[model samples]
Target: MRIGIVGTGFMGTTHAKGWVETPARITGFCAETVAEAAALADQYHAKAFASLAAMLPEVDVVDICTPTYLHLEQVRLAAAAGKDIICEKPLTLDVETGAEMLRVCEDAGVRLFVAHVVRYFPEYAAAKKIVADGKLGKPGTIHLRRCNYRPKKAAGNWFLDDAKSGGLLMDLSIHDFDYARWIAGEVKTVFSTTVGSMDKDAPVDYALTILTHEDGTLSHITGGWAYPAPNFQTGLDINCERGNIHFDSVASAPIRVLIREEQNAPDVGLPASPLAESPYTTELKEFYHAIAQGEAVRVTALDGLKAVQIACAARVSAAEGRPVFLEPQGGVL
Candidate 1:
């Protein structure tokens, strides 16, 4: 399969690397400038197309690694050209646009795969499997923490712009939001509190969102771009009626599970295995295989839409200082 990548930023470069690990050919790239696309194209031994329209005919699949706001137009262009799409996460800045993107792709009979890479992470994937397998009977409370320093190299300071990047919650915390919903089920309500500044000179931003799932599972998700130290950390603690599963990036062993036994016995911790390949690579490979085999994608466009909806709702909740309840149809009401 031929692949054309859009956006020559960090994510665009990362997608190029992941695609190289697969059997697909990196046909070329489309970016803001010829030089930007050429830089990435040179690394992959591919061409640098001058425009998305020019790049479309050269490839069967378009991998969109552009910013959140650019997704709809890119997806529309690709779908119009009858090309399959792989879009970067938080599909679009809003629900209507994301829904329209999905509708266009479906009407065009082209596959739409959203890159929610966290679902492919070994630890996170295992946690989902464990919960699905009933190993953690009736999950109750889930605590997820993801913290990292703000992107110092964000050109034009776009990452700090709430309208552009959706600030820390949409761009950074959406991973945890997706994961939480994946494991806990549909979110019924969301209550959120945000602290820190979006000022260009400010060094920090943080947000905490509490999600109540339809299944009665409560998830407390905390995300930050405010760490003084140069460290990235992500951890998950899932408490269930039977036992619990935990993973901390800072821990000696990243993942561990404990299951209750014989009514009242000591909890026995079981070690979780590590992934041989990066989740990004795995995610691309899965998308490739799904497209090749005409099978269902693991991360569907609807999943991406729901995640963005939740994140957008969180933003509303934080702004209004009230818990936002979601409709059964995945909209805040």
Candidate 2:
């Protein structure tokens, strides 16, 4: 498989690092400018294209790591070129365009995978397995927290724009929203509240969302952009009929537990994983195999769209200070 990257920011660099671990060949890169593309391409010993149009014919997959607002156009171009796509999270700023992108890819007979890397994390993956294996009966209540500093950006950067970045709910909290839906079930309604501002000069942003699943399972998600660098942390606690699954990035070990007796505090002190490969790399490798050999991946374009739908509903709930109801989804792609 041959791939062409289309961004040069942090995610772009991180994706590139993962792509290198796959069997796919990194064919080229196309950034906001040819110079930027060339800089990243040079590091990977790949070609640098002046435009996506120029890069399309040279690769089988167009890896889109561009900003959320720019995804629709880039994805359309890639689909038009008859190439598969690997888009980063949030998919887009809204579900309408994300659905269109999925439709375009499907019509063109190309696979569309979204990078929801949290699902691929070792701790999260382990939790998923434990839940699936019936170690924890049915999930009841889930609490997910992701906190990190505001993205380091220059003045007038798009990260500060609510319309472009979708603030913290879509940018950061979408991970939890997606994970919540994945672990519990489809969302039936959402109620959310937010603090801080989306102003360019604002130093912080935060949101808390509550999702009521179709099966009555509840998920509360919190996202914040007020921490210092290197202080970023993610924690998840899932309560179930049998036991609970817990993980905190700041802990010595992120783990899953099976409760036997209702007496005494459950013993819990699992150790950190010794594996060197990152969840990002594992995600990309899975995507590569799915595209190259027709395997199933954890995240698809429809999943991405639904994630956006959930996040958008949260945005609306926050804006209106009322619970937003979601209709049963049919075919959008």
Q: Largest TM-score belongs to which candidate?
A: 2
TM-score of each: 0.90, 0.91
Candidate 2 positional error at 17, Å: 0.7
| RMSD in angstroms between candidate 2 and the native structure over all alpha carbons | 7.7
lDDT per residue (tens digit) for residues 128-207 in model 2: 88988997799999999888777766445677678888988998899999999889878999999888523445567888
Per-residue lDDT of candidate 1, residues 143-249 (tens digit): 99988767665257677777888988898889899999899889989988888523345567889999999989999999988764445678999999999999888
Scored by lDDT, model 1 comes in at 0.84
Any runs in candidate 2 off by more than 4 Å, and if so which?
Answer: 197-202, 253-274, 331-333
Native-vs-model 2 lDDT? 0.85
Clash pairs, candidate 1, are none
lDDT by candidate, in order shown? 0.84, 0.85
Q: When superposed on Cα atoms, how far off is each prediction in RMSD?
A: 8.4, 7.7
Which residue runs does candidate 1 get wrong by more than 4 Å? 197-202, 253-275, 330-333
TM-score of predicted structure 1 = 0.90
